[model samples]
Target: MVNSKFEFTNIKCYCPVDKFCHVEYCYLKSVNRSYKYFSARSNIHQNPITNFTVNLALLKRYNGYKPFLYNFTVDGCKFLGNSKAANPVSKYFFEFFAPYMNANHKCPYDHDLIIEKLPASSMDYRLSKLLPFPEGDYLFNITWLIIGIPHGNIQIYGSLS
Candidate 1:
């Protein structure tokens, strides 16, 4: 797809240095993780069109620990194509998320990514595979982190087995 234009604001950053403060760095890293794990498990190993699951532990063991990023755009072609954007609170299931994820690099694995965490209280989760574009018509905020697993409806995605 050809490139387009955009504009956005309301950003906050947390990086090792100001040089690494770019949101795209963190956002793209997260996407590449999902692509490597989820896209590989679903498309290559299990049923790509329906429910397929993989242990998050396996992903960590295989792909290295995931670097959780603040909610940001991973797939921004829509904005790049038509100048529109998506919301963080919207429902997203990365079913057909391969094309967008594989756009940058190849994801090779036998299973799909299905995270399993202790279902914590006051926390509901849905896997995020897409984020808004990082170009014009964009808004960004970054934050630092400590080691804690993300909270979401992870159980509903796949079984613990």
Candidate 2:
């Protein structure tokens, strides 16, 4: 595979539990001609997160973003505990932001969850070689469910060429 280009076009974060949890900031930043950053911060105001699940959906731009390759839900706590044991497809996506995220340990997260300054290059290898995607627009729809209730939704938009 020749050097593929990956860029984050936009990011939108929505927290349903506004009083309990809210997104502080979410944006895509361009540092230079070839470097871009994806950053987000969410704050939990109530009890710490003990049990949670994440729903991941990959969509491609086919007549306005139709579901494509994969979609599944995994226990967030379990994945955090042993990422290797999680489904390979989900594990691959999780690994994309694992190094930049602060929620790496077990449950009962008391502090803010943040993914700060995650460069697009960090995911280039996975998108190019690990599980190659056709050159097109794509969206990663990720939802956070706390104890069965939807807490937040993060939609990440990007393109490969």
- Per-candidate TM-scores read 0.17, 0.94
Q: Identify the runs in model 2 with alpha carbons over 4 angstroms from their true place.
A: none
TM-score for candidate 2 = 0.94
* lDDT score at residue 75, model 2, on the 0-100 scale: 93
Error of 1 at 146 (Å): 35
Cα RMSD, model 1: 18.6
Residue 85 shift from truth in candidate 2, angstroms: 1.9
Model 2 steric clash pairs:
none
Each prediction's Cα lDDT score?
A: 0.23, 0.87
